[model samples]
Target: MKRILVSFAVLTSLAGVALADTHGAIAYSPSTSAIGWSYAHANRGDAETVARRNCDSSANDCRIAIWFRNGCGAVAVGHRGGWGSGWGYDGREAQRQAIRSCRKQTGSCRVIRWQCSENE
Candidate 1:
């Protein structure tokens, strides 16, 4: 049951990331079992470009992705530039910290405008 739940949450998170439309935003939450994260690539174009932008932005924070595992959680909002470049932090701090770190890392990294709640 736990594995099934986790799998479902992970799948949901992946779907969200795949469908995300970049617009410069940051979001996050702490989870005991599972977590999620994502970034938007609006004007930036592709993941590489988005990663560069997120890293270049000076906002100091950006929304990543929505997540769910045991209870519920959000992805570690890395600096805008840390998206596709393999740069990012863990989901430890609150949503604000995640955004700050994400934005701090690169700057140009954009994220979804809003945080989406898990379906399950």
Candidate 2:
């Protein structure tokens, strides 16, 4: 009986952890870098706000907004000289450039697109 009870407790604890939302959803170009960039950002900080903002703005081409429960990291795309007047960049270079530029900002703004290039 003792062994059975102990096994049940362990299983229950494991199941709880498995069911938790441990990672955020990531999306990337089919040809460009990996899509799980946002997941990495969430791992470093809060994943919920990051996932919501990115997922919601994924379809839009204007502002690729990133939010955190603590703060925010964003890049103004589709603005002055922005891709397609804000439609945003279509190629990998454009995305990478944007991320690189965003990273230059001070504070938690280091997230800049939260990108990760496996090739690089």
Candidate 3:
């Protein structure tokens, strides 16, 4: 019974850790035609602020593409007018999805940024 109580306590602690919030953000700049990304922030605002700052450093007209909590985000641009973004639990999957989304809109697409929040 004592061992069971100890195990329960450990599990509860682990659960709390897993529940902690983590954030990721992606921003795009039209002036420089660049994308900036930030991840593993403790809050959504921090992640978005960092990403926007990074983008603004290189160019003007910066805008956030996405913000994710406990997940991943990605952005893609196409040869013509197609642009896409995706968010998911897996970083690679998010990137792939972003590219895929862009391709659906246009024939050519490439990934610009991919970021993931730490799961804990």
Candidate 4:
């Protein structure tokens, strides 16, 4: 009964970063409740691969929820089987957005994971 949506902002036009870009991605499987994440990776593809590969060890339906460069990302899960993800320049902002996004279709949701990676 889990519903998940992934944002395709990967390699977007405004994907340029500052001096250094530390890529990160978060993967989750609602069915198995498995979570995997990568931070400070070389590129988006690598970051996503690591996260998905890690989660794949435990989940059959794991999907990349969010990706970000030189920032933070978060995932929120609702008791009613709803999930959402958000990323921002900081952990608090990322978590806030994650909860807000989750509350869109759910009422009882809380953040399960969050991480930040600054440009090096």
Rank by lDDT, descending? 4, 3, 1, 2
Question: What is the lDDT for 65 in model 1?
Answer: 38
Query: How much is 12 displaced in model 3, in angstroms?
Result: 2.5
Per-residue lDDT value at 106 in model 3? 85
TM-score per prediction, in order, is 0.22, 0.29, 0.80, 0.80
Q: Write the per-residue lDDT of candidate 2 for residues 8-33, one digit (tens) a residue.
A: 99999999865543333223222222
Q: What is each predicted model's overall lDDT from 0 to 1?
A: 0.36, 0.35, 0.85, 0.85
The residue pairs found clashing in candidate 4 are none
Please, what are the lDDT tens digits per residue for candidate 3 over residues 1-120? 999999999999999988999998999874566777788899999999988888857477789988899899888888886778888888888888889888988888888888888732
Between candidates 1 and 2, the one scoring higher on lDDT is 1
- Cα error, residue 8 of model 3, in Å, equals 4.5
RMSD to the true structure for each prediction, in A, is: 14.5, 12.8, 2.7, 14.0
Task: Please give, for residues 29-107, the per-residue lDDT of candidate 4 as tens digits.
Answer: 9998899988989799999998899785858899999888889999999999998999999999999999999999788
Taking the candidates one at a time, how many backbone clashes does each contain?
35, 1, 0, 0
Better of 1 and 3 by TM-score: 3
